[model samples]
Target: MGYEGEEIEGYYCLLIAILGNFDASEARFLYEYGPDHPVCQKILKKRPPPVNLAKMSKEEINQCMYRLFEEGYSKRSIADLFSCYPSTVNRRLTIGKKQDAEKKMEERRNQNNAQTDRCPEELCRGKP
Candidate 1:
């Protein structure tokens, strides 16, 4: 049967999902056996892995994740790309949100403190 555009896209998505679940040796085995193999067919038919965030050490990954999040990618999508568990993505996003909130609060506090440190005369003069 000839595949349509959607079908081809779906097949690639399945392949990507399966690839994420496989280690290097398994991937090599699949590559050696070729796509026409029964195992390969079965893997392709199987459901893709759940969305999970990958553990990232590099600042680049962090920046990419932030950008993806800002661009409105679902957590599952990010997890799928990173080959990590969905919970990992959620945890990281949560931590980031908390840190951002804390930073903003600190900035506001500092601004308020600076304003308070200025004398009333300075406030009237708009010099502080």
Candidate 2:
């Protein structure tokens, strides 16, 4: 009964995959694919809509942006989620490319170091 965030993300990915619109494993779907297909309305019922942004600091916002960017979201879309202009998103995203896991963790640590109130001192030392 206690599903984690990664599990929820996997379920979303499975929903996207189940549309059966992606390229087939054997490369046949592309040749036989059409621009239009039937869609099930209920597939997105569990998806949560974007909520109003609370008093998120610059570091907090950047943390979210980095995570989403690493997960392959477009700057414009990430801006929309944050209710800001794409140009702002571009400015905050200082890195030019998707980062590897180790790099991402280092960046997160560096960011969290300045946010001691948000992330406790224990978390800084890697203790739960």
Candidate 3:
């Protein structure tokens, strides 16, 4: 059976998701020539979902946020992808930063304790 126009358009949307680039020129081309045109034939092919941002678990969301942040995506963009508010993203990022800082501080404290344990007499002698 042949695909209808709407089905073809849906395929184009899926293609856009796969390609991850739906610039103005591409939109104009698609609109001007329609999905059935020769240039759009490739787009008619189906592809799996690019990324299932929605319905992610808490751990997945944290990982996604960090990855996106590392990739230079703005908080707003990350929020949009996860279907949440920008403030939620911001708050999560803030909390993550705080936790990271605390972790580093704890590591440093442990290192200092180890050094002192290794040279208890030297440390007790103090600066001369």
11-127 in candidate 3: lDDT tens per residue?
776676446545445655666688799876543332122467567776566756766676667786667666689999887777666666787899999998887676667767783
lDDT of candidates 1 onward, in order: 0.64, 0.56, 0.65
lDDT of 3: 0.65
TM-scores, one per candidate: 0.46, 0.37, 0.48
For model 2, the local distance difference test gives 0.56
Clashing pairs in 1: 52-79, 52-84, 52-85, 52-86
Estimate, for each residue in 45-114, the C-alpha lDDT of model 1 and write its tens digit: 4424343335555444555555567667668767776777888877777666666667789999999999
lDDT of 2 by residue, 43-94 (tens): 2222224544687776667766776776666786677677789988887776
Number of clashing residue pairs in every model? 4, 0, 0
Q: Once superposed on the true structure, which residue ranges of model 2 sit more than 4 Å away at CA?
A: 1-52, 95-128
Best lDDT goes to which candidate?
Answer: 3
For all the candidates, what are their Cα RMSDs to the real structure?
11.7, 16.2, 9.1
Q: Which ten residues in a row have the lowest lDDT in candidate 1?
A: 44-53
